[model samples]
Each structure stands twice: as C-alpha cells, then as structure tokens.
Target: MSNIIARFHKIQVQDGVKVWYREAGAAGNPTILLLHGFPTSSNMFRNLIPLLAEHFHIIAPDLPGFGFTETPENYTFSFDSLCESIGYLLDTLRIEKFAIYIFDYGSPVGFRLALKFPSRITGIVTQNGNAYEEGLDDRFWGPLKKYWKSYQSDPVFVQSLIPYLQDPANVIRQYHDGVADIESVDPAAYTLDIALIQRSGQADIQLRLFFDYQNNIKLYPAFQRFLRDSKIPVLVAWGANDTIFSVAGAEAYRKDVDDLKVVYYDTGHFALETHVVAIAEEIISMLAENQGY
Candidate 1:
C-alpha cells in the first residue's frame, strides 16, 4: 500500500486568486497535473491520487470558481483566464516539465496549456477530454449550443437556465447517469458539489463559464493541431458510456497522435469514480514506457 498522504493547500497565484490544490508523493518524482471538469473540482481525483501517488507526484488544483478556490466577484471566468491562473500556479511552483490529466472543462484548459508550452509537456492523459467537433454529443450539447448562441442577447433565456442549474437532482444525475452500479459512486462527491454550487455568486460563475465554453469549441482545431504536431505520448483512457463527451472523443485522438493508447471503460463521465485502479495502472504503464518514470 502506498504510504503517501495527500496534502491540501491554498496559494495566492499571480492573479491574486487563492488557488486550492491537492499535492501528493515525492517532489522529485515525475509530476502529473490533474485538471478536472464542469461542476466538479480536483476532488474528482481524490480517489485516483492515492492510487498513483506511489509512482507520480500529483498536483490537482481547484479551478478558480470551483471547490475551495477563492475567486473574486469581478474575476473573468473564461477558459483562457482559467488556464492563465493555472499557468501562474505552475510557474510559481516551478513545475516545468509534467504530464496533464485532462477531463471535461479541463480538456480545453489543458490543451491551451499544451499549445502555449509545447516543449514543457511530457505526455497527456485525456479522460473524456475532447478536441473535435464531432466528439461533442449532439443530444447533450443541443441545448447548450442554443444558450451559447443566445446568452448575449437573450436575458430571459439566460435566466431560464438558473432553475435547472440550481436543481440538486441534476447534480446527482451527473454522478449517477450511465453507471451500471450506482452504488459504486460515493455520495459525498455530488453532495459537496451541490453545496459549492449553492455558494453565493457561484451559480453566476458557472453560468458564465458555461457560455464561455463556446470559446473552447472554437479552439478545437488548434488543440487538434497541437496533438498532430507535438505527437506527445497520449493515453486516452475514457469512459465509453459518457453521454456528455461521447466515445467519438476518445477515438478522435487516434487520428492526430502517433503514440496513443485508447482504453475504454464501461462507465460514465466520471470514470475515476468506478475505475480508478485500472486507470492508474494504465497511466503508470504509459509513463513508464514514455517517460521511464
């Protein structure tokens, strides 16, 4: 059993936002930056960290508006700004060369980081992190696309989504949906998410960020170009059953990356919740083969 205990911290980044992050394993070991997705924070990696800490030094941060991270009310909550905050954190920590574990909203942020610092990235582990237009599931994105197009002009329409955003059941569904064994999911995950979403001004942050997600879609080609040009060793261990980001997203990596391994789990969006061990093993094997760590 791994003896490494995860440590929690809050650091003020260059932008003045206090970033809350989880760190584990030895500092000298190979680093893995774990970026999480929508409605969830680094907490999603809580179970996965201990499993991989023995082999990797883990850095999982709560994005500006999520989890324990403190974001000023006036802070701009776009994917670009999110990446900038994370970049500052890395620069402050002097983390030059490291792998990225991207998922959901993290996908865009991580890809942007890769584009900015191509040489600094050692490898990428994308779990339901997408970069292709076709990878987006029409059913899940249909309503979101409408919001993206109209949010600027339609005040009433934008306000209409608030009720759905405030619904605890919707948050619960994000954890329960597409999972064969619902009992496998820990309730504390969504429970904490629900509490955080209810925080003052948090709903607005999430809503604005949701709209800003359109920008991520616009950068899909750039992200793809980075993969094709960099050809960094990529491990695509995705949840085949994820409705938010379909299996096509997982397969899309094969076209651009020359060194890629795709492993599909029969789970949902948060695959780590169910298949943490297998994913950790795959990550270790991939890093060993590529980075000799």
Candidate 2:
C-alpha cells in the first residue's frame, strides 16, 4: 500500500497571487505538474494525486481566481497572464524541469509553457485538454462564441450567459454530460465547483478567460508544431463522453506527436472522478516510458 499523503500548500508568486497547490511524493522523484480546468481547481486532482504520489512528485495548483488562489486587485486574467504567473510559481519552487498533466482550461496554459520553455517540459499528459480546432465543438462553444461578439457592444448579452454559467445545475451538467450512468457521478465534484463559482468576482474572472480563450485556439497550430519538432512524449487520456472536447480532439494530437498513447474512458469531462485508478495507472506507465524506467 502506498503511504503517501497529499499535502495542501500555498505559494505567493511574483505578482502576488497566492496559488494553492497539492504536493506529494518525494522531493527528487520525477515531477508532474497536474493542472485542473474550468470551474474546478487543483481539487479535481484529489483522487489522482495520492495514487501517483507513491512514485512521482505531484504538484497541482489552483490558478489565480480559482479555488483558494487569491485574485489580487487589478490583476489581468488573460491566458498569457496566467501562463506567466504559472511560470513564476514553477521558478519560485526551484522546479527546473517537469512534466505537465493538463485538463480543459489547463490545455492552453500548459501548452504556452511547453512552447516558451520546451526544455523544461519532460512530457505531457492530457485528459481532455484540447490542442486542435475541432476540439471546440459548437454545442459547447456556440453560446460563448456569441457572447464574445456582443460582450463589447451589448452588456445585456454577457449578462444572459452569466446566470447559466453560474447556475449549479449547469455546472452539474458539465460534469455529467457524456456519462451514461449519472448515478456514479459524485456530487462533490460540482458541489465544490459551485462553491468556487460563488466567490466574489469569480464569474467575471472566468468570463475574461472565456473571452481570451480564442487566443488559445489561435496557438493550436503552434502547439502542434512544438509537439512534432520537440518530440515530446505525450499521453492523451480522455473521457470518450466529453461533450465540450470530443474524441476527435484526442486523435488530433497524432498529427504532430508520434510518441503518443491514447486511452478513452466511458465517463464525461470529469473522467478522474470515475477513472482515477485507470488514469493514474496509465500515467505511471507513460512517465516511466519517458524516463526509461
């Protein structure tokens, strides 16, 4: 039995956002930066951390304005800003080089780092984190794309989306969308997300990221190029039932990365909730292959 215990931590980065992180495993073991996505923080990695901690050092951080991470006044919430902040956090911790485990919102943030400091990324493990245009399907992004059109001209239009985005039921839907068995879904996943959504200015911060998300899409080709030229090993573990990012997104990486392993689960966006054991097992093998263990 692995006796590792995940510890919650907080670190103040260069610009003063206190990023809350969870850490486990030994100090010198191969490191994995586990990053969570929209509406959730490092909290999403709760079940996976302890599983991976026995063999690898796992660090999962709540991005600025999410979870326990404090969003300082006047801080810009753009994806570029987030990448810089995450970079600072890594540097402050003396993490010279580490692999990234990305999901959803983390897809863009992790890719930015991989491109800027390709030498620092040992490998990448993506769970429904997209790197292609097809990943942005209409059903999930149609409304947000429309919001971007009138967010500048019509405040009324932006307000209309807020209620749905903030609604707990809607958040629950994001968690349960593709899962065939709703009974297996854990209530705490959306429960914690809804709590985080209730924080002051949380909705607006998310809206900023949503608006700036187009910037991420613009970098997809660049990300693909990095994967190809850098020859970075990748593990694409995805929920086959993911509504926002479909199975096609998982297959798209193969266009650039040849050293890739793909696995699909029957769950939805929150695959970890149901497939943590299986996912963690694959990640172990993936990291070992990268390190020649």
Candidate 3:
C-alpha cells in the first residue's frame, strides 16, 4: 500500500457543512471521481486509487456526516444535500468534466450530481450501485425497513448495529460473501477498513441514512431519465454474488442507459477489493474506447 497519508481537504457547503475529500494522481489527466458507499469513506478506494492514478486524476470525497467530514445537527443528510456538496467540491476543484465511479451509497449521490449537471459527466462506472428493484433484497434490509418505520422511538436498537459494521469477523464474512474468491483479498485492507469505520463514527450515519433511503429511491426514475436522455457512456462492473445488490440490479443499467457495457465478476458488494486490477484495466479500456487514452 502507498505510504501517502491520503490527505484530506474540506470545503464549505450548504448551511456551513464542511465536506472533506482526498485527491490523487496528476491534475492534468482525465479526472475520475470515486464516490464511496455507507460506513466507508474515500478510504474504500485506497488500494485502487494508486493504480488508476497512473492513468487518471482521482478524487474521492467523504460525504457529510460520514468519515472525517463534520455535519451540523440541523443539516439533513439527504441525497439532495449530498449531491449539492459534491457539486460544490467539483466546482471548487475547477473540474469541468469527469467520469464517475459509483458504488453503494455513492450511487444516489453521484446520480443526483449527474442529474444536476449532465454535461459535466462524461462516463460512469457502476459497481453494486443498484438503481433497480432487485438490488434491495438482503438481510440488511429486513432490520433497516423496521428501523426506518420507527427510528424516532427505537434509535438505540438502530444504533446497536454500528458495532457490526466494524466487526472484523463480520468484515471477513462480508468480503467472503461478496468476493468470487476470498483468498485473493488482502486481510489488512479489511482490517484497515474496519479501523477507519470504527474511528469515523460512520456507522451511526449509515443507520440514519438507511432510514432516509426511500427519498433516494424516489429519485431513481429521475436518474434513469437523465441517463436515457443524455446518452452518457456507462460501464457496469458488478459483483454477481452481491447479496445486497444482486445481479439483477446490474442488468437494470441496460434498461436505463443506451450506451452501457457490462462485465460481471464473481464477487459481491466490494468487488473492487478482490478484482482491483481487473476493474482498473476495464475502466481504462472503457475510457480509452470512448474518450481516447
């Protein structure tokens, strides 16, 4: 792993919420914005960023209330707020155009960004970021749905789930269940991820966001429409074994975007962890095929 600190930078967004992000690679190269899922920060891409940095400028931001970013008590962590925060980041960076890698919670935030500024999005790479109905089925959702219904009263029960997010044993299970080949994954990476999650207080935000997910689902059709109308190139690199966001969700990308190319890996939600080199090569190829190397 790279020894660099993966430095953090912050920008003030709506109502004084400070958003933090990490940047890597040459600024002159084509930009690739990596948006991470819940309970994880830009740290999720720590291993893959260096590889992609050789070919593209990479930016990964920790969404408000997650990771190192501080969120105010009055701030609403809605998809809209996230999108706006990202937009502010891009604007601050002066990145007029870029490609995006959307995963997990990253999907909703990136989708909203695309909707707001379609011209800024040149291409998209989706991994386990489901816009389809099939992606919602999983053990996680059962409790999530119940919690969503009664979050105001049963906050403690919801909060209790935070430990699971940082459990080493559970992280191992998540990797094994998600990856096509568990042996290929790096144990330290999982440990580091768990460490970061534990240190960041991200799990609490994740639980809060779980209840707020319906708001994003309602905007899915709008994202579908944006993709359909804009004709932006899309690459779907999915973990076929992902129990949370199933293979069916990968298939749904074809339904929404006209220029979608897909590659199904035998992994789960964190497919990039096990298939980093393959995913990087595929993304490079996709960008080259569309925008030239």
lDDT of 2 by residue, 1-293 (tens): 36788888888896668888899999889889988899888988888888888788888989887889876799999989888888988998999879999999998999999989999998999999999998877889999888878889989889887888789888999888888888887788789999889877878888888999988988998898989998878999999988899899999988888789999999889999888999999998988655674
List lDDT for all candidates, in order.
0.90, 0.88, 0.80
Q: Say which prediction, candidate 2 or candidate 3, comes out ahead on TM-score.
A: 2
TM-score for predicted model 1 compared with the true structure: 0.98
Candidate 2 worst ten-residue window by lDDT: 284-293
Best by lDDT: 1
What are the models' TM-scores? Answer: 0.98, 0.97, 0.88
Arrange candidates, best TM-score first.
1, 2, 3
Model 1 lDDT tens row, 1-293: 47789999999996569999999998999899999997889999998999889888899999999999987767898999999999999998999999999999999999999989999999999999988887899777887899988888988888988877878998888788789999999999999989888888877888988899889989998998999999789999999888889998888888899999999998999899999999998999999655678
RMSD to the true structure for each prediction, in A, is: 1.0, 1.1, 2.9
lDDT of 3 by residue, 79-120 (tens): 778888889888878999999999989999998888888888
In what order do the candidates fall by lDDT, top score first? 1, 2, 3
Model 2 spans > 4 angstroms off: none
